[model samples]
Target chain A: NAGVIQTPRHKVTGKGQEATLWCEPISGHSAVFWYRQTIVQGLEFLTYFRNQAPIDDSGMPKERFSAQMPNQSHSTLKIQSTQPQDSAVYLCASSLAGQNTEVFFGKGTRLTVV
Target chain B: SQLAEENPWALSVHEGESVTVNCSYKTSITALQWYRQKSGEGPAQLILIRSNEREKRNGRLRATLDTSSQSSSLSITATRCEDTAVYFCATDSGQGGRALIFGTGTTVSVSP
Candidate 1:
């Protein structure tokens, strides 16, 4: 298995601009998840999808952050009006199912909003 | 949000020594997992101990789960410098399709 694939391993965005990150989940996996990691906060869950339907997004910031899984194979996370405080590593992961399964993670996209 | 707290946020040990990291979680869970993440890399699942199981082991790594106390521990025996990395403990709550709630990681440094 290719594990989970995420695009644009590194991204640099001007302040107030937008950035979009992409992820291709492992084949046949039914669950996809997004997380944000930083030196200060460690890792925090942002959102999750099951079978292409969003299951929960309570962890996401109420403003300027959004995520979508248009199909079983891929998901995308977008940040609008990015700020320097938005700089962090965004990671995507996939698991065979939602319960009692081990998750596989992508190398993550390092977003630097300058 | 349910919290998973890990202790000894950072530890430094010499190669060949043994080290242990502890974690505690709030709320019941279906399973608890241990993951290792290298610098500048994604985290990888190392072990998953269901609530019913008390212990699980893989190679040089061993994990113990205590559902009664809502706690878990990951231990590395005969550690190698290559094992140096941040380790995180995550919980699967059996809800919301098994979304994992991760803890603040324990950074381990194995000196050569």
Candidate 2:
């Protein structure tokens, strides 16, 4: 299996611009997760979806950040009016099930907001 | 506050040496996982120790969990240059087990 696939391994966007990161989960996996990693914050859980439905997004910033999972195969994380603070590696992961299962992660999309 | 925290922000060792990383977490958890992330790649699970499991081993890696103390540890033996990576401890807590809460991570550098 190719595991999880994240598109545009690296992205460069000007300040105030928008950035959209994409993730294609492994076949037959029912859960997908999004996380942000920076040198300062390490790995921070952003949101997650199960069975193509958002389960929890409590970690997401209340403003300018949103995520959606239209189907079991794919999910997206979008940042509006990006700021330099948003510059970090956006990681996507998937698992066969939500609990007690091993989760696989993609290489991650490096988003650089200049 | 982070649910989990790793001790010793960074560690370095030469080939064939052994190293251990420790992690402590708050609250109760069903399971604890240890992941390793190489440069430019996402983290991958190295070991998972459930609340009922006190120790688990895989190849040259060993993991110990003390649920009583809400802490866990990972040890790598006979390390090689390829063993260089950032190690993180994650917990599956009250979030419906949908996502893992990660620690600050310990960067392990193994030089040849």
Candidate 3:
């Protein structure tokens, strides 16, 4: 298997600009998850989807951050009016059902807001 | 958010030394997973132990889960320089089948 695929491996955006990250999960996986990793916070959950439907988004920032999984194969995480604090590695993972299944992670997209 | 706290933000040891990382969660979980992440890379799953299980081993790595205490530990024996990385513990909360809350990672540095 090719594993999870993320596009635009690196992104650089000016402050107040919008940034979008893409992820293509493994085929047949029904659950997709988005996480942000930084040196200080470590790994923080941003959101998740089950069967292409959002199940929980409590971890998402109340503003600017949004995620969508339109279908089983792909998902997108968007940040509007990105700030310098928004810079971090965005990671996407997929699992068979997400309960006890092992999640396979993508290489991740590094976002740098300058 | 349910907190999964990992102790000792960083660790250092020689190649032949053994090291252990600890994780404690605030809530009950169906299972726990251990993952390793090198700098600039995504985390990779190393072990998964369900609530009912006490210990699980893979190669030179051992993982123990104590559901009653809501905690888990990961141990690496005979560490190598290649084992240097950040390790994270995630808990399956048994809700929605979509969430796995993660802990602040432990950065392990194994020197040859």
| DockQ (CA atoms), all models | 0.79, 0.83, 0.74
Per-residue lDDT tens digits of candidate 3, residues A20-49? 999999999998999998877778888888
| RMSD (Å) of each candidate, 1 decimal | 1.3, 1.0, 1.5
From the highest TM-score down, the ranking of the candidates is: 2, 1, 3
Q: Lowest summed-lDDT stretch of 10 residues in model 2 chain A?
A: A95-104
TM values, all candidates: 0.96, 0.97, 0.95
Q: Per-residue CA lDDT of candidate 1, range B43-98, in tens?
A: 99999898889999999999999988989999999999999999999986445446
- Model 1's number of clashes is 1
Off by over 4 Å in 3: B94-97
Show pairs that collide, candidate 3: none
Candidate 3 per-residue lDDT over residues B1-112, each given as its tens digit? 4378888889999999999999998876778899999876788999999889999999999999998788899999999999999998988655544577788889899998
Candidate 2 lDDT score at position B54 = 96
True contacts kept of each: 0.82, 0.82, 0.79
- Runs in model 1 deviating more than 4 A are B93-97
Task: Report the Cα lDDT for residue A64, model 3.
Answer: 97
Evaluation by TM-score, superior candidate among 1 and 3 = 1
Between candidates 1 and 3, the DockQ winner: 1
